[model samples]
Target chain A: MDNPKHGMTLIVKTITRLTVGLILLFGIYIVSHGHVSPGGGFAGGVIIALSFIHILLAFGKEVALKRISYNVASFFESLGAIMFITLALLGIGSGYFLLNFISKGEPFRLFSSGLIPLYNVAISFKVGAGLFIIFVILVTFRLTKKDDRE
Target chain B: MLELQILLVFMIIGAIVAVKTKDLLSAVIAVGTVGLGLSVAFLILKAPDLAIAQLVVEILVVIILIRATIRKDLPFSTSGRWFFNTFVVFVFLIVFLIFGYICMKDLPKFGEPIMKVAQSFLNNGLKDTGATNLVSSIVLDYRAYDTLGEATILFTAVIGVLAVMRKVGRKK
Candidate 1:
């Protein structure tokens, strides 16, 4: 049996690892700078998705799946969604939903956006988890089913 | 205007490519690029919130498409009726032209007085609502019901996906 890692030559492996690392770092940058810049939760989320895609393409779906299981991804997605909705419901007591019912402590500070930062965090988690789950489920079908050779 | 024109051209190309592609996977990717273009346009229009929402929704839609396509056997074909395709293209052009004309004619100027009013509300209304983010204040407090409905939609989608993808004979 050929090892899955054998699928990629040394150069390819190095490039793939570098690409994945850069993409993940870029995603974090986008998410953190969301309030101050144009890139926010959604852009950051897609960046993370691209990172996962790079890993899958470079290392194969089986390796990626092993690192991030379908079940765990789904659970993270569900949990993120639940957390977002719960934050919204907290607004209902004050006659609104998804309301940042907190006070903006200061201007132009990381924590100054009140619940905006928190919301961004939640959205990032939801987008990342959702995309990962989708990719896993879709790619699993292709990886698992082998052709019958007589 | 030049940049906008270039972006518009790219968007048109992406859309046309998406429509003409027969391979489901490639088509899906083209569609995603088109969506990314649209989101960029939204950002240029100074609607960051809408842009973010568009990006997120587009990602979700593309993921859904990928999952659906992977499960099914789809064949790619380049052959189709030319006249029918031309007719569809003509219809799309006419509809889009009219829509663009209306938008150009009637849309509010960016940073209009109403926007200032909204900004003031966010500035002052935070104290009353006890909210930090102006956007969040607008979304959750001023339009709580809308947020609830949006959340409900997400919940429904989650339930639907779970139901469709659930394994058979798996008892709780």
Candidate 2:
């Protein structure tokens, strides 16, 4: 806590900067490949959120907030929810809540799944933004002994 | 299977350490270790998806605990009614063991299940959902409503956190 400005040691910061992008890329790959891979929206979204939080930990709070402002995170979350609801509603044509209305493509290909990939994307958006907001909120309202000292 | 048993032992040790540790940080670490062990167990159980989800949830849980215990200190040795608590726990354990034993006769055999739904999915998941992965098809197509509910839950939780944490009349 000597130098609060630098959130962590140089090694952590360097490592974080190097791997954050890779983590983010991996998360995207997982989300996009949900129809074929073991991971889907939830796991990939968590990894994406972790990447942002990693940036926050390696750098300071201010820097991380700058990259994903509160408004932007809120927007992503809302948009994801709306998109999901709309997709479900669109299934009304097929007489179900979330019927895969879109014609199912050839199996085993990236573009095969009817609506699963889209749903995965929506879920990822919701999860990633929600997780980041939870982290940000917790960090902001963190309990401290500073009041007693003052 | 042997590796899984070893990890389960580690998990049990970690659980005991978490329960018995005086320091909150040590307790968190011990619980996290148990989480890691559980993820490994999931991997051994042939569920990489579960393992990934468990690992991520474990990390998020540690973060939440760290936030909650920033300056709070709860001593492990502060209880004076330990005997009463232990007695109650033992009573509950015995009751549960007896009940489980009674129910065991009716339990299905291990490694074999009446998996009609699973068999159908295995047979026609790709044809139905055009997804090669049966897990994905089941999650997003067959159980899309469940997925929707999960997303809604996350959305509501974030809104709850925002309502609790946001500064009044202050835009940042």
Candidate 3:
């Protein structure tokens, strides 16, 4: 009996394995430099989520799930939401909702923006995890239904 | 203006092809090409943010559409209903064009913005927010509430999708 792999051909898998890391890194860069650049947490996070999805397409569901399990993804999603809210709430400490409480360093520096970069990070995590969860749910439901039928 | 019109034409062609194409994959590609054309238009309009967002979104949409098609056989609409569908489409198109004409008649022409709120942001966004990037200053500082609302909507959507999928899985 052939225990076949779930995803695409060898070349695709190999390319995915090689490029997924690069994609993830690029997403992080975009998220971090969002203030200075065109891309932001939403865009970067989507790219980050897509990177994981690329793996899922190239390798198999099992392999991709192993890298980032459903529970972990769910946890990050919640955590990101909490962090975003917390950032906003913390602004209240400065006498305004979502105020820039921290000292803003020199412009163009990585740490210049007060709470903005942190918000970007939180948003990136939330968006990335949420998107991955949505994709996983969409893909896995049919498989689970099939199992139930069996 | 010519470049912008060229891009719009490409997008118009792409939209027509996307709808008319029988093959699901080709339709998706056509839609993606439309997205690309729209992004290029955005770039020409000097909205880098919109351009980047559009391009990324278009890619994600194509991926999702491809994934969806992988499971089901996606047949184009048969010629039997084509006449009716085409008629509806044309009616909508005319309605849209008329609405667009009405709106555009009063609207500022391309790149000419009569901005009040935007004027404030443009003038003092840096002085107030201490952020060099005005776009970031506006989004993260000047209008954080709107961003919060948007993020919440996204969260709600993700949760809804997850819940719906799980229910379908359990029922089956």
Candidate 4:
């Protein structure tokens, strides 16, 4: 499969790879240190989505689409929404809307946050899948040959 | 101070590039860069909550722009509507000036009494909420309603995408 063109070159490819790796690592750092630093699930998730966008720009939309199909991405997005809502319901039981760690109070530890970690994971999945789906749809529309249009 | 100046310069460049770019996709990305810069600035100001909100909204806006305009050619040049551009610039300048003044005046001093209050809240409240993460407590307990609203906004965006991108005869 040949790479589709969108001004991608070898330098772009190399930079994209390095950037994606760095973004993923940085995202983990952000989420893990969210309690102490200026980062959390949303920021981490956006960083992760950016990694996918870098891949799309470097490797082409076809490679990205193949790696994660639209259907699967949609499923993950919906699943994340469901999980978030479920957690919110759990909070209602405790007179809150998404409270976690009511039972286990482990402060100053990564695993200490009961639902925080789970929320981060859910958000990451949702953000990644949502972004992938959006990119695929947009790029697919953009890349279709003019002659192929109805 | 130097880092702040550099960040401000980069932010201005990103915003100008986003507004002036001809290519729609590049413009979208330029706008994203602006948002990214603002989020970083938010971190510097110790407003992580606002930063997260900014990032999430930025991503959603980018997605919506892509979905809406991907099929059309992104026109870089308008007929140079001078009056409209001037009006926009004037409004932007006024807003920026006001915000800049407010920020300078109302911002808390670094390492002040408020920091201690904030710290004590995090230190003591973490145990009661079962969340070791101070940010998580801020998000899920102290301000869970805002988080819920944010999630709903995303959900609405998903539904909007479904409505716009749906093909004929596709089952809902």
**Which digits, one per residue and each the tens of the lDDT, describe model 3 over residues A95-135?**
98888888877777777778788888888898899889888
Task: State residue B145's C-alpha deviation in candidate 2, in Å.
Answer: 1.3
Better of 1 and 3 by DockQ: 3
Structure candidate 1, residue pairs in collision = A88-A98
- Candidate 1 on B1-172: residue-level lDDT in tens? 5777799999999989988777778889999998999989888877776787688678767876876776455575548797899899999999999999888767777455456667767668656544444555565356656544654565466556556555666553
Q: What is the C-alpha lDDT of each candidate?
A: 0.69, 0.86, 0.83, 0.71
Model 4 lDDT per residue over B39-130, tens place: 88887877766777687668767766765656566445446787899899999999999999888777777545467657766677766665
lDDT of 4 at A108: 68
- Every model's DockQ: 0.21, 0.78, 0.61, 0.34
Displacement of residue B107 (Cα, Å) in model 1 is 4.7
Question: What C-alpha lDDT does candidate 2 achieve relative to the native structure?
Answer: 0.86
lDDT by residue (tens digit), candidate 4, A17-123? 66778877887777666654566777776777676666776787767667666787788888887888898788778776565634554566666656766676677
Q: Which is the better candidate, 1 or 2, if ranked by TM-score?
A: 2
Better of 2 and 3 by DockQ: 2
Query: Which has the better DockQ: candidate 1, or candidate 4?
Result: 4
Q: Which of the two, 1 or 4, has more TM-score?
A: 1
Best-fitting candidate, scored by lDDT: 2
By DockQ rank, best first, the candidates go 2, 3, 4, 1
Docking class of 1: incorrect
Q: Order the candidates by TM-score, highest first.
A: 2, 3, 1, 4
After superposing candidate 2, which stretches have Cα over 4 Å from the reference? Answer: A1-4, A142-150, B76-80, B169-172
| Deviating ranges (above 4 Å) for candidate 4 | A1-29, A36-38, A92-97, A143-150, B1-40, B47-123, B130-133, B167-172
Against the true structure, what is each candidate's TM-score?
0.67, 0.91, 0.89, 0.67
